[model samples]
Target: MKLLLIPDKFKGSLTSVEVSKAFIAGVKKSGIPFSSHYIKASDGGDGFMNAVAHYKACISVQVISENPLGRPIQSYYLYNQESNSAYIELANASGMELLKPEERNPMLTSTFGTGLQIKDAIEKGVKNIYIGLGGSATNDGGIGIAQALGYSFLDKSGNRLLATGASLSKINSIDDTDVFEGLKQIRFFAVNDVNNPLLGKDGAAHIYAGQKGATKEMIKELDLGLRNLDVVIFDKYSFLYAELPGSGAAGGVAYGLKSFLGASYCNGIDFILELSGVNDLLTKEKFDFLITGEGRIDEQTLHGKLIQGVLALGVRKNIPVIAICGKLDIEKKELKKRGIYDVFEIQDSTKSLDYNMQHAADLLTAKTTEYFGLLLK
Candidate 1:
């Protein structure tokens, strides 16, 4: 049998490459006579650079950037000199994986570091910048990035406020006079795989901030802050982005990008899959199974995430699709409706979360072996 393996990173645990290796190991142990083709998949999260590099000639440009909490860290983005373009992953700097779970507070984190990388690209005279807008740890609505680009958020007293989720409600005005002159000339694209709006129950704060370590009370506050920001942004720039699909992505960073930087949005999975020539391969061969997944499988997976994209491909090609995830929260009925035949969750619930994350590769291998071994034996 021929199989196709493509999965996102396990998030703070196995990278997609590592996941693929462990998966292959498991399948070998199952003693199922099978051949597999591995694709290092990315939906605008950790392995975005890998996808871009696969698509073009590019090199990494390392820079000293900051973490989500303003801690200095080493980061990099892919730069294509031939096209004078840059591909930056927000997760490289402002990602949840960078922090301990206890330290993941949306109200405190910032995307300033990602912005620094963008500024660097622009200063290098790069004309097009694509920013991966998934796996972010902040809910400040992209003001942190705008701050690095020389936009200022000020309160009624005209005192500049530091860009964070807590400050989103305090902004009385915005100033863009000091923004990089080349900003308007550069094309900005927010790449993600979600279609969440910027406000209300289905919006960024209400839907995503909880994962960024916000309590229910905090989520409400952040949502209110985002609403306040939406009004302030409209008052100053005459732009309304809150209601746009995907505006809520990356803690409303897409909304912020559109409001402050004039960014366009695209589906990350579609872009990467097309760029990596996976579409061509899918068309040329009919694999027995197309396997895809990520760290968590939940209701959100239906909302334009990587798995959704993979499922779409599976339906179009009449291929069976199996999903593997660290945590599985969706139902069998839901999976059936999405054209996914099965899902395997690899976590060992008896172990502490720390243990599970630490030994994720081994756990995944064991789980895969158990499932396939039992099924095929």
Candidate 2:
């Protein structure tokens, strides 16, 4: 039997590659003569660097940037020569991971470092850039990024604005002449997973600001700031990005890219799938079973995710596809109805969270072994 295992990062637990290893160990222990293929997968979230780094000769460059709390932090950008472009997970520089529990203030954070990464790629003579925006820790409406890219925001008094979300209220004018000075030949693609706009109730500040540690008052202020920035940006470009899908991504970094940098926005999975040649791989291989997974299997899995994307392909190929999750939440019948043929949860019935995390591979290995035993029958 030929089996293909493609899984996303298990988030806070196992990586997709590690999970594949456990599956292989299980299949081997089952005494089954099956050809297994491991394909590390990501949906433009945390494991992007790993996916790209595995198959590409990625060069890393270090840069100084600000953390969520306005403190200095060191971050790195990865450049791929095969594509003649540089890739960045914007979160690497300004992600929520850079902040402590007490320092998760969205109003004060900035996407400045993300912009610096863009500038770095430009300096490298890269005309095409791929940027993934997830795990952000800011709500600056991309003002800081604009600043990093040579765009200047001035107050009514003609003073430059501060590089924070709170400072957007003072912005009265935008000067992009210097920002646009470079060759207009560059093409940028912003990879984002969310479709929230830049403002309004379902927008960036209201829907996501609370998760970034913003209070009701702060959310209001951040929304206002983004609204004001939208107005100023529209005046200069004659375009309004406030309502563009994914414009709210990374605290409105998507809006900044569209309004100022003329960047195209695409979902992270689509971009990664194309870059990794997923379609080509599928066309070249015919498998008896397709296995896709993530850290958790729940209602959210119905949303556009790596698991769903993989299953879509499997369904088209008329192959039975199973999902292996770190934990399973929804009923199995429901998952099956959603095109998941089978679901496996890797929790030790009698283990602690820490214990499960540490021994996940072994536990998964054991479970996969038993699962393959049935397959052999």
How do the residues 98-151 of candidate 1 rate in per-residue lDDT, one tens digit apiece?
999999999999999999999888888899999988889999999999999999
Cα TM-score of candidate 1:
0.92
- Encode model 2's per-residue lDDT on 87-146: one tens digit a residue: 788778878887887889887888887787778778778878877877788888777777
Q: Candidate 1: lDDT over CA atoms?
A: 0.89
TM-score of each: 0.92, 0.86
Model 1 residue 180 lDDT score? 80
lDDT of each: 0.89, 0.80
Give the Cα-based TM-score of candidate 2 against the true structure: 0.86
Off by over 4 Å in 1: 348-355, 373-377
Q: What is the lDDT of residue 321 in candidate 2?
A: 93
